[model samples]
Target: MSRRSLARFVALAAILSMFGTSAAVMPAQAADQVIKIGIDLPVSGADASDGIPTQNGAALAVDEANAHAPKGIKFAVDALDDAVGGVHNPQQGATNIRSLAADPAVMGVVGPFNSNVAAAEIPVSNESGLPLISPSNTNPTLTKTAKYRTAHPNEITYFRVCATDDVQGKAGAEFAKTLGLKKVYIIDDNETYGLGLANVFEKDFKEMGGAVLGHDHITANQQDFKALLTKVAATKPDAVYYGGTTSTGGGLVRQQMGAAGMDPAKVKYEGGDGISDAEFIKVAGDAANNSYYTVAAPNAAKSASAQAFINAYKAKYHSDIGAYSANGYVAAQVIIAAAEKAIKANGGKAPTRAQVLKNIQNTSGFKSIIGTFGFDKNGDTTSPVIALWTIKNGAQDFVHQINVSTK
Candidate 1:
């Protein structure tokens, strides 16, 4: 052979060694089409315990989807923090949604954990035709009332995986009765979610023949709840129900109960999903004992379909699932399912926001690790279920779960 022929043979041998014999016959793989899922939550401060796990759940879904996504598509998470000064801020949530909406690559968003934040972001997402599926927002007016729909009444872009406060509050009231607590005092954080949940709990508790000694509201981040606890102690109530989250005085109220001579051990404390966080326990300290809370979503740990998800979640995050973590996963599943449908209809191209939105709205009978359910016309979960939990030994312990009738 000539020198040129010998060099060519050596180069061919190197190529064969690099890729093996099948490389010559196999076609080149196409680059994956990237689709982004935006996550908006309070990822810092007191709420980080809940926010981080919720984001992890969604991120886990993205990881799984990317691993098994169609031959030419991939998923990514664009998580953005909507917390200002360590708490969830509505204005910040609105800004985050606007930013996500501006990104053509972001097909959907999962966030605004607090209901109040959801209220501010709904209008922006509606106008942008971007879907906001929440893992924890549970205020009824978000979907039941017309106030949030003023921007675009014809189009509903907000959805959630959890039951609304109306159902959760009623369930809590019923649970209180079951616990043989006849007299109760209610306190709220004077915010949209807290106040609304308190109102429902108060009304239902009264209707069930339970005495509501008194109801009070506290300012946000007030830091001092001694006066409120003093008044609550004077009532001699069997239980003190708080309608708020840890960041908004849920933990402080329980902790101050002891300072006001209302031993948390003797006086049972209860609250909604707002207070159902690890931060609440940490802040409440020894007073965390005897504190019972309700979650607006079904018990994922109890769901037979959820075992696999629980295993997968633990494997990825190396921690137990948070209250709304499964809800976050389900929310992401809804978005991914919708994206798949939209992409298929669009001939395998990146789907438009409107296309994704329409597909999301059409989601029905979708089965997830949590359960089989779908979005109703109002974009609320058809599975309106709530779970009860308590703090035992400074950690969360599942009590029981019940399904609430939305009708």
Candidate 2:
């Protein structure tokens, strides 16, 4: 199915809608080429526990795409590992981007989950004109700020399905206030995502009239946060806010906090999406309770489509999905939509990079497993809903959701 053909079918569907009839958007054509959706992930090492689920989600989308693609529009996924030394590395991520963008078959990419990796790869992808959609990079500046435009000048190829850190940070701060946490200590793993989120949370908490006791930076992937926990315990904060992923010591921090004699009933634990995964509970063990988390996307159980996605994922991979699985799935869906539009618009031919990019930028009310959303001028999601959740009996339980507006 060429992008040019998609237009004719869409117009037909729209006309049918007026007549109170609608049609599913699927077309079959015979072509000799295959379009590849590149997926960059930390498939090996510590973060792989988090990144693998995202990869599995994207892979599921890829499989569905291939099954339904027009004979002329075959789709595939090229998943590359961006992890080195059991963690996310910006240099490795950048190298992966350079390689993926060099491939002619790759129309777009669907990963680089870590914000630090996204920060590293964005410029390289922009230079190569390869549009990249991230499932888990929540750093605000990636799209919500001018950092992309500042680096690329006339180009903007980076996009994300997750809410920005600022949104999650503000919401977490609000949750802290709601829990009567006036004094808090902030800590981050010093990665681009964690450190930036911590900064946003600290600033927002202060603005809400909460007192910030202090801030600390921890080494990524360190198992022993006992020394740091001991220091934080002395501050007598009402709560401790950690702005880092589970792979970057979130579990250790929580466990060590308990070891340091912090009263969870009073000294609550607040964190962003990094600590909101099932893996966190497995790692933190009994120390996972009394923790609250703010995530950019809702839990998969909240939607029928998302549940179907989970079922299909389990049916295929024989494992459960993770926190960012829906994110990766939606990101791939966005790219697939663009590919369809580009092919239909190009007179039944394979879509060009510019065509796909333009279509993605113009996507509106694109309903996926995650939710209905479209990119704004900055390639940020126009309708962003964040969720507040907490661990209950060894599971992440949702509390509430809020629509976060950039304005």
Best-matching candidate per lDDT: 1
What are the RMSD figures for all models against the true structure? 3.6, 12.2
Model 2 regions more than 4 Å off: 1-31, 148-151
In model 1, what is the error at residue 302, expressed in angstroms?
Answer: 1.2
RMSD of 2: 12.2
Tell me the whole-model lDDT of each prediction, alpha carbons only. Answer: 0.90, 0.84
lDDT of 1 at 178: 88
